[model samples]
Every structure is written in structure tokens, then in C-alpha cells.
Target: MSALTVSQEEVKRLKGIGFLNNKGTDDFSARIVTVNGKVSASQHRLMADAAEKFGNGMLAYTTRLSVEVQGIPYEKVEEFQKFIAQEGLTTGGTGAKVRPIVSCKGTTCQYGLLDSYALSEKIFHRFYEGYRDVELPHKFKIAVGGCPNNCVKPNLNDVGIIGQRIPVVDAEKCKGCKKCAMEAACPNGFAKVVDGKIHIDTENCRHCGRCVGKCPFHTTDESIYGYKIYIGGRWGKKVSRGRALDIIFTSEDETLDMIEKILLFYKENGKKGERFAETIERIRFENVERQLLPSC
Candidate 1:
């Protein structure tokens, strides 16, 4: 803290590599990259050792799921990086590229329909690491949620992927029971028996899959799993709720490709210093959607 030795320019350069300057001190925090907020037990232990060895002996967690070793002097940055590197860890998640991928614990949760952890792993390897060098108009953030629970706040990111389970009814198997189990199981009352047939209000059904296989007659016995994508969502000083694409991607490949296409669109058409939401607004969501969606 006595006499700043590191110049402002040098600090900016360090930030590009995931080192954040500590206020009122020459110390910096090294942000270690993490995928879906998960790391091996050995990785965690190595970070703990690095925190005490080169940092202030304390570690901080970022909202994006990266770990930070706080209080490392400017000179010890390289040493800290190397120490964690032995465990195959690295420091990054800054700049105008894809930020860290976030995954909710939806896959393990009772309501979860998708494997949030696995999907996020694909995103991290495919985009976060794959697009590491591809600069965009601004930082791009991605989040994967396992279900409609929105535990990860996917709608708040630039690109959000949420899992969905749409119930498929076998009308021939339905028996319009006097006391319908599907009706009782449906949290939203979207399922009902009318005139010897079970009807699902497509407009109101949340596709939560809770009612699937609930009917005694096996009427609602099957379901379709899909991913709902939202684009152009932003949060902070200015907030923009992402718009859901018209189609529900039944294949993971389509969802992943959609993400890449959106990134490409932004990279080519977006203006410098503008967020993806702003770009979408400028170009008009209607036009953007038409180009991105396969049907259009």
C-alpha cells in the first residue's frame, strides 16, 4: 500500500488474464476458471494451498462460479498461476468473449428435467474454451437451468438455456375416471377429464412433467424433453428480459449450434462497446429471430 509500484497500464493488462486489482493496495486477486461452479476435491485443495502461499490466505467466490485467491502481490502473480497450473487449473473469464458457464443443480433436483451439469460442461468446453480467442462486441454470459424453476436465472444472461418436459398424452389409453389422478397431480390444474377424454390445456400447461404417468389408465404416460432458449437477456444497471425462441430444441446439438450462431451474429453485426441485448434491440428482435430460427 505504500507507494504503488505497478502502473495503471500494467494493472489493466493483468485484468485481461483474470487478475483483479485490490483496492488501496498493490495486491490482486487471481480468478481461477471453473465450469458450472464445480471442481475436483484435489483442485479445491490446491487452490486453498495457493491462497495461503501467494495470496492473503482467503479465497473468494465469484457469482459466475470462479474461485479467487485474494491478496497476492503483483510480483507473485506468475508463481500463483504456476502453482495452480500443476492441478490443471487456470485463471481467466474476463474480456469481450464468452464468460464462465453457469449451471444450476437442476439435474439432481426433483423438478429438474435436464442434466444441467452435463449441458454446462459441454458449453464450457465448446464455447468458453472454444471461443476463448474470439472477441465479441462485449462480454457474453451463458447459463443453463435444469427446469422451469429458473434456479440459475438463465433469463438474466445473454443466452439462457432452460430444460423443459412436455407431457405427451395417449388419448386412446385415457379412461375419463370419475376421480382423475392426473388432475390431482397437476399443480396448475391444466389436466382434466372431460366427456370421457383427458384434456390438457396446452396454453396453461407448464410442461412440468409432474403429471406424466400419473393417470391410472396410462393416459399421460409419456413426455418429450427439450431445451428452451432465451436470448438478449441482460441484468445490472440496465435490465432486459430475454425473449424465448419460438421453437423448443429437442436436440442438444441444435441448442449448442444456436448459441454459436447467436455469438457469430453478435460478433459480425454488433457495434463495439454494446451488449447483446442492445444489438438485438437495434437490429430488431423480429428480424434477428427470423434469421436464427430454423423454421424462418
Candidate 2:
């Protein structure tokens, strides 16, 4: 007998949440509550209590420092959210708007280069309210990374912000010990000993900024500023990958401007219900870039 291959739908058991309607309506009627920043043990207790009281006692942690409450009927969503607000939480990630922006766990860990929490705050303060009620063709996801380790997988998001620093090597000062290559734990094997000299494979290295910390002789450089942006990526039914939008070296204002420009371009040119990736696919990458990034 052959083993059965379970279908994804069967495995998911979508109707288990009871959000589905009787006539076959989409399961987009659920409301969520988001509580970010320093999460306390007390918060967990409250969440559990509230879930059992008002919700299904089921909580789902989102990638963007929020939680979802499924199974709430359409009529009771507002009331559920109101009850949740009393417990210091409010509805978020509900509707076709900019969801909570998130960043990798940075600063708390040794591997982190930038302050993720602070950056997330910046994004929220700048654009969150503006997008609260605005409708769009599809859901959008954005993530920021402090380094090239890709904790947020910037290459796979609609808009990805990754910290980057140009490495400057001092060849004359280098002893050719190859410690950076041999001992350092680089996933891409960027550093290597060529002709008894330490050679950094720029292409292979993810520019994760780890090598800068691992180098014994302090050969790695970290003076450069700015981020690399990617656009038009998503992971749902129509899986698509984004491409490098640009290598921008400027203030946070510039980065946000670029993102808004791309979004606006998509809104103007894209068909109804078409996502950023779909628009990109419909129009060639070059044309899209040319229209969006005229300065590039």
C-alpha cells in the first residue's frame, strides 16, 4: 500500500476556527489585537484570560510582534476588540492596510548590528496612522534586518530594509594569517587564503557585518551607512521573489520616500486586486523601476 500525501487544505483544516460562513464566504472576518514592545509575563496571563473569556483561548503570534484572535463572528469583532483594548491591547493587522512593521531581534543579541526596536518604532510613527484605513489590492509585508544574516529575509518581502556597510581591507597591514577565513564562522565562506594572503570574496559574503566582528586583526570596515532595498515579493498562492530596488545611502527619510514612491507607482499602474509582485510581473522590472525610481 502506498502512503497518502495529505493535501495542504486537509492539513490546515481551515474550518476548525469557525470563522467560515455558512454559504462559503471568505474567512477574512477575524479581528486581532497587537501589543508590542517589552512583553511581560503578566501580559501572557492576561492574554490567556481574555482569550478564554472573549475569544477561543487561541492566540497566534505574528511575525510583526502582534497576536491574532480567530473565530470571532462578524458582528462581535468590534466588541471583542473593545474588550481586548481594556486589557491594554487593540485591534491590528485587520483590513487592507499597512500592518505592523517589524524588525529582527536586534541589540538584545550579540549578533545584532542595529537597533531593531528603535527602527520599528520609527516606521510605526511615520506611516502607521496614514495607512490604517486605506485599502489596497492585497496585503503587504515589510521587514527590516540589522545585518545580512537576513533574520527577516528582506529579499522575500514587498519592501525590505537591510543594514549594509562597505568593507575596506588594509592589505599591507594584513599578516595573511587567514583567521578571518578559517576560524570565523561565515556561512558563505567569503574569506579565503589565496597565495598565503587573506582574500575576501566580496560576492560570496552576505555583508552580514559578522566578519567585521570576527576578524582578529580588525581588517573589516564598518564606516559605510544606508540600506539595500528590495521590492515586489510575496509568499502566498502566487509566490514571487523581489529584486534589488536600489543601494541607497541616506537618511531614514530617503528610505521611506523610496518605499512610498514604489507603492504609489504600483497603485497608479496596477490593475484592481493586483499586488505589487503581480504588477511587476505584468510590467517588466526595468520599466517599473524607471517609472518609480527616476533618480536611480
Best model number under TM-score = 1
TM-score of 1: 0.95
> What value does the lDDT take at residue 179 in candidate 1?
91
Task: Give RMSD to native, each candidate.
Answer: 1.5, 7.1
Computed on alpha carbons, the lDDT of every model, listed in order, comes to 0.92, 0.62
Runs in model 2 deviating more than 4 A are 1-30, 35-44, 63-65, 71-76, 178-185, 195-197, 213-216, 248-250
- Candidate 1 minimal-lDDT segment of 10 residues: 1-10
> How many pairs of residues in model 2 come into backbone collision?
0
Give candidate 2's TM-score. Answer: 0.77
Q: What number of backbone clashes does candidate 1 have, counting pairs of residues 3 or more apart or in separate chains?
A: 0
Whole-structure CA lDDT of model 2 = 0.62
Error of 2 at 192 (Å): 2.8
Ten-residue stretch with the least lDDT total in model 2 = 18-27
